[model samples]
Target: MVTKIRKSQRIHARIVVMDSDKEAVHQLMRLLGKEGYKVEAIEQINKMLEKIKNEQIDVLILAVEAWDNRGYELIPTIKKMNRFLPIIVTSADDSIETATRVREQGIFFYAIKPLDIKEIKLALKNALSKKFVSSGEALFIQKEEIQKAFDDEILDLADASKILKLSKPTVSKLVRNGELPASRIGNKWYLIRNQLLEWLRVTAAGNQRNYGTLILETMDEGVAVVDRRLKIVSCNSAYLQALDVPRDQIIGEYCYRVSHRSVVPCDESSCPVRQAFRTKRPVKFMHINYDSEGNEHYCDVIALPMKEKDGKVAHVVEIIRDNTETYNLNRHLNWIRSFFAHECRKTLGPIVMNISALVDENLSASISIERRDKMLLSSLCSLKFLHDMIRNYIISCKYETEKLQCNKKSVYVYKNIFPQIIEEFHPILSKKGMDIETEIKGERPIWCDPDFIKIAFSNLINNAVKYGTAKTKIVCWLKMTDDEFEFNILNEGVGIPHDKLYDIFNRFTRFGKLAISGTGLGLHVVKLIVEMHNGTLKAQSGYLIDNKPITYDEFYANENLYKMKDKNLRKFARFILKIPSGEDTQKMEV
Candidate 1:
């Protein structure tokens, strides 16, 4: 049964309802009025403070959803106006976050939406009774005694445990350990509420500091806190690990001494920490640092300033990330670019000079027909070499940047592509006294990008001719299976070393004669093209024994082949390429 307030007591009590929902406000007003309380309803939040200030309000029912939930923000303000006013909060939101926030604001009671009339009546009756008791106590106790009671408000074990959200045993342990401010009186422990609150505040702040420290310790990047004097105040484990120093040796040491191994500070213009302090803002830059053992590192440093209440920079937090590997890679790429440019100029210079000499009337008249023909041939060879170099370099770059795409079509290798490529290399082949012998067993047309296949064959054939011994035969073999096509090229020469066989396929890698002028990107480009078509390329180099080819691995395994003299054994280099044929090619294209 809902207990109603007595007629005499309800005559003086004033209850105000603040909500945007007119229907809920009307219901609350009618219910409370029937209970003999003088109830007033106000929709506007702005008028709430005015209503309270002008009249004596014993209870306030505030809807948190009113005025876009600004009612929660007004709790502290309302309390400041009348500290003793009983505020009952109502909300449609029943989430724990909302309930916790409302309860923390010192509301008398919290009710979910569609407020229960019986519950509100009971809460109002209890609030008024408590207010009357408080009024009576105020009159009985002297003001000085009330102040004294608040200062020394005694609490038993249950009260302390409840307030601290801890079990009784834990609270007892705390009291026994002297961690909590308490006193033993007549076999029971008593605590002061004021002292306990102070202890909680201090403990909460310490936990926050510990949380921040834990976060820093878990990071992969090195983090350090430095004071205004550039002395390291504290650092995480990563910072110590990066510097390869003990924590005791790092703390309180100068940041410059620990990071740069310098007696003085680093240059202010380049130091991100110094810049952050000067600007009172965050700064980031790259830095070169040395560890304890003097190993150099390229570091990316970010510094954020810690400011004081007066807006003055107090300290700077430095975050260091190692970027040495990336820096070295970029430097190496830059060097390769420079080398390519030099090679282009060197090749082009000769071609221009030769053409100019032939064009001059005086030079042409002095030159014999035989010499003129030789000069033309030399110019054409140089032009071809330059053309091949530029084409391979461009293709390599396209593949590297992921812009190269193959246009596939059926191609007869021996009939259309191989013959043309062989004819193109005739000049160089005849000059070197080398001959190419082909044994093609495949009659089926291979599904591939004809242009790319042509380039791949040209590169292989060129390498074979360039490195082969004079009067040696370069063997080319092609065979087709049910699902794949295989091509192999074998050349007799001063073969590539076993260790460098795989390395020769890398960009700008050359293992052959240094006197021969050729771009190293040809083999790399061929490897890229082959891989793009879902194919594989491999190289083997060793000596031929009994007309049968023996790889370096096999030769090393056989003691007899290993002991053979250079004059007795014929060295050879071979490359094998395997590519998917016909319908198998469509899967990779997709």
Candidate 2:
């Protein structure tokens, strides 16, 4: 019953063949033997189970004619014994009914009896390709103990405790207390390692199964597990819904087949699955997966290898976290900061020249006093506004990367960050003839980057001024929740049409009152800083039902419903910049 495959060390496999026809069975043996395959054939139903347990097998080829309904009966038991084993069933009947019945039973293959050598070889090759098992056999096996019990009862408390290094008394106590299963052997108790190990495996598998189930059941993260061959094995409901995958069509398909919409695997540069397999390590990247309907989603992906007992990789587990909002915002912020920085640099020289000319003209009396003073004042105001804008842009960029450069101090958020932004923007607000105020409903610093928060709020206030009417008041409200701090800036002007609320945050979307010249990146930058602190940003424009809009709905109908109102305002673009926190920002600079 012991058959060990050799010669083709590259092809490591064990095969078991059982046939009732003596002459046909010998023919199979001759063919397999000539091909240098180690194969065992058994005719008796009783002997099949024993041979399967004793010998290692990559495949089991059973002749359905061997024992009439007996072959059908053995299939379930064999599967239970080892679910990974591939079973190929053959029948001499060649009837469609028999083939159909065996197919329903989940046999790996169904072939007519007196099987063609070609068919058998093909089935065997296909089965062997997917076979995987633990390695490193131990020499100190307890044969006597293994022989005394059935497959399920083979591993007993005595053997398991011995292998696990627990005292027999403790093992016995565990068994007696129903913590472990034990069988009575006359007047003594016995533990078989096979049974005990299998039990341990089942329990361990159960724990992992439940853990995955819980995550998929409740977690917002979408997850999927793909095998080493790049085949998708399982996915959670969230993954299916997020990917918009047709469950029946995807279950047996390869990962790339579904995700990339490719006929073959993606090329080396784009294949995260291949990298994970090649390096035997986890790989993470950001990707946008689109379904058949062409709906795109932003996903943060992590692929981890699942190793076998020998430490060889068996599969890869992929966890995808959606980050569309964060990514778009960061992208928009970078563009905004870069563009504004360029503009400020360009305007500085001109403003300085204008001021010098005005001073010289006044001193020389070459220009009228009124004209000189007006020129000087306008130039100064332009210089001041541009300088402030540049500073805010720089600070916003720093905060986005968690590298805000300033003295760090502990102070209540309302007392420090909020006041700084309000004070800095007060002159600009006055110049614009806009009234702005801050109301703090919280009293703690809440452990945050103050300079970052200040600049972020400054951008918000500036946006409100630039977009609102000249005589309107901008209300800045700060509220601290159980685990987060929220800030809201409200302005009265031509409100952002509901559709454009989400669109305005997009890098190129500058839609508001006509007078405000903007890069359409200010709100995008604000969103980036807010998210960098693990907070969220949202906007609503409309009067409150109670003349005080506390919730988004109270201000206007849910903006999201009006898809065409302003498509890009409220839904800001996102960018992902991997940077250290304020505490670790020094590492990047140094």
Candidate 3:
């Protein structure tokens, strides 16, 4: 379908010349005619397009300075007419800027005008070789009197995908499911094309116990072979079974058509196949794919380039590995850590704020004894709540470091942990008039560590109470699944930002405001305890509350905690604590 004819293939090849100077064109045409090239002269840029469309042009030779823009507009116009056609730009001016721009556009070759015949022939050879054989001239083509060329390794499923231009899932399923004949080395799967085509010819004859059939019966992945231009030369049974895509739909299509699901020609810098061809280096990428039902899959893709006889590339091999489960587990773990950190920090800020206010106001001098006693009791409760928070954090850290242990003792988990946290937060919640609700979904007497779970629940509930807005209800509940238990605390308040969700679990990471007096350890301790118990914990900020959704980003963004304030002793203490967590954590002796 390509328009440009190869110079060797033509009886007397036509050369298209675009130059403003008549003397130069006349002289060039005379020299070219003597060298057996028919000259077709065109002066205007607009006429050059017509000449390419109308006449048979083997090569386009243009004067760089004469076209004003060096045929930048004409290059694409001519290329659009014939993509494979070779264009040679000759410059009387050898400026680096012009050369760099020409090279950047992927020109066939660049040289000074009043050109040497030897250099032009070599450039023409290179361009024609690429135009015929593609990128690296590595296409495994054998002509009469010429020997066939190939790489040492067997062709792989990756190679098949490239040749067939199909998705990896479709290909891998066939290869790994034993519907094709392919061998594996470590993680790489390969196929032999010569053996496969013979098998196909046999299979078409309806006698199936041949060597190729036996190999296809054993293969665990899909396999196909492609030329440098990514045309399907052959395929096997395994490839068909895995892809779930009919061979008639994919054979002879470009590689990216199936893999990338794109119809446009690839931009060199952005195309993975082109990158491999340009550098002759293998590349592996982990990519995510989503199905129509919204299920996600993680795929590991590896692509390697094959070279032709002229040291140009002719083919590419691609392999795909599915690792969906592993990706999900890691993503879940990260989200859990982030949620806890965010919720814990939000609760921590208010405690610090109340403490600062308490210290500043002299309650004894102005308030009566009854009110004073009430206020003092409230402050003491806040301190105890803070203490319990710190304890939860320390326990979480111990569990992470593998230092937490269970005694396997029977204990009343709710009666012990609930009362302590509730008593500690009673005065504070009472002052704010915040209603606290707790419910045990299904209590079971199973083997468990009471104190660790108590601390974890305490952190979650306390966070709910502290950040829960005035007149809002904070509900705490727990449920038991088949093999695991779930604890949830819902509070009507501002949620955490989506961007900050991942970083909340790291030690010493305070999300917003220094108003809360916390050790930044609650969630870390919860994570540790969950790990120790072989359980998991997760925190969510933007859940529906009483049939209404709250936007947290704008809420937290406008908070006073985000603003700079006058320095205090608390800030100094935080500054001092920052050093050990930064450099000392890595220096912790074995």
Candidate 4:
């Protein structure tokens, strides 16, 4: 007709190529650009969804090998995002199964690798010109025709239940409750096939929403939904609890204002919610939030997008898990490591210097024999201290990681275990001018792991010798009760404060004197060992008054004990270990 085409009728299409192979993508892009079409290339699968959602893409060339052969899996989601967008899948796999699966996903074409450029061009031209029947539109058309046919087709409750995949009783109840479109005819409810199917679809959709709500409510992790405006749409109990905010105040509130108390939103790079909305993809990151009282909390946040029908992000579902306690524990562990390193260096520094001097012939010759012997003894003590510390640390780690198991057996604690432990510590006892006075009232072979018992008592005695006043007595009482084995070690030394007594057995806890060379794991390890044997450990430290053990609290309450002289007050610390000896003792053995 020789008529000019309208501006709106001009053919201008955009094509996106998703491929892991760079050279292939470049060649395709150049070919498409030369054909006077706008082309974009994406190498990462994560970026593909965002590009499709943000841009008006007419055709997509998806390489099956891209994202490790997971490219085809994206076809369904892509179709959901844009029903009319044509996807031409390219695969190196020439298997019929792959081609069939790709076609079943409703892709425009399946092109095998070593692709023909001319064929791809022709497919592109056809895809651009072809009219697409969206699934939603097709479903609507099918439902209209089905409804007309169903006008004459009637079904009873039993028949409707089969089609709905529901129990007959459920269908009857729905009919009784007027939930399903049905009518009573001759005492039996009858439903149209189309109406029954329609009712089932609506009910299933509602059930899905209920299931989602139930899941969100039951989860321990905080979950919340936020719209694009940064306003919270809904939240679970945990979400409210995490922020310590009232439920009434949380709904409809700006997420930034509620969580951060800030006027502006959080930075998109750090905020998972914002990033999910911006990228139209799932995001995960660590977030630091502040409570109502301005306390910092560490949280692991995962934000997933809830997309609209048009492939735009409508809301983000944020899952928050509180990691504040775990974070603090890790920080404390790192601090313990640093402290341990410092202790090792402090203990080794003098030993290294002493050894260097001993190695120097001139230095050794000039030193007195008595002084050299003292140095040797001091070095030996230091080495023993370091060795014990390391051993305790290893045992403590084993206990924490649940790798330590007690091999329990019936053993004589007083005769076999105590003697060896005493003999081992004889040198340290003599050096510290300490004497262990044992009052043995238990002669029975207790049911326990002998090696573990030895280690337990050794740690207790070592602790007594370390802090007990020089030349003071360490009184040990071993008694056998009808139901349990009782052992107590009372030493006159630095008394623990009332507050510090509560956490005395906690890992890496040290109090009273910081200058003492101890790993702080000795008592903790002793506690673990005692517990492993179905026993209990208790510590009491204070002065004695009226032949009764006065606790730190009593000492502080009484003005007389508070003002008493240090020498007369008689500060003492007693640790009691009691192991059950009843019938359950047999079960303690692993």
Q: Please name the candidate that would achieve the greatest TM-score relative to the true structure.
A: 4
Of 1 and 3, the candidate ranking higher by lDDT: 1
**Candidate 3 lDDT, tens digit per residue, 1-590?**
33343444332455687776678788877776665556788876545554555435667887766565456445644554455567888777678977777766656778887778778766655654543443332222233212121312235566676755667677788777655555443355556555445545655676533553455446565544455675554445565565565564456666556544445645666555566767888866775544335566676656667666797777665555567777756754664576457654555565565556556667345656676556566656656665675565556545545686775444334565567777757776777788768787545333356776676666666655555567777776655333345666667755444564555555555556637555556666656656656665555454342344433343246455334223220110000000001222223332
> Can you list the residue pairs that collide in candidate 1?
none
Tens digit of lDDT per residue, candidate 2, span 88-159? 987888788777777887788888866888888777766765543224222122345344434543334455
Q: What TM-score would you give candidate 2 relative to the actual structure?
A: 0.38
Model with the higher lDDT, candidate 3 or 4: 4
TM agreement with the true structure for every prediction: 0.50, 0.38, 0.33, 0.50
Better of 2 and 3 by lDDT: 2
lDDT of 1 by residue, 483-551 (tens): 788889999987888788879899888865467777688889889989978999999999888867899
lDDT to native, each model: 0.79, 0.63, 0.57, 0.76
What lDDT, from 0 to 1, does candidate 1 have?
0.79
Q: Give the clash total for candidate 1.
A: 0
Off by over 4 Å in 1: 1-299, 302-316, 319-337, 566-568, 584-590
Candidate 4, 74-191: lDDT as tens digits: 6755654455567999988999988988898888888998888888977876775553233221111233533444343556688788998889998888777445666543356566
* Minimal lDDT window, size 10, model 4: 132-141
lDDT for model 2, please.
0.63
Q: What ordering of candidates by TM-score runs from best to worst?
A: 4, 1, 2, 3
Query: Which residue runs does candidate 2 get wrong by more than 4 Å?
Result: 1-342, 363-381, 384-408, 413-420, 440-446, 478-486, 503-509, 512-515, 543-590
Question: How much is 573 displaced in model 3, in angstroms?
Answer: 30
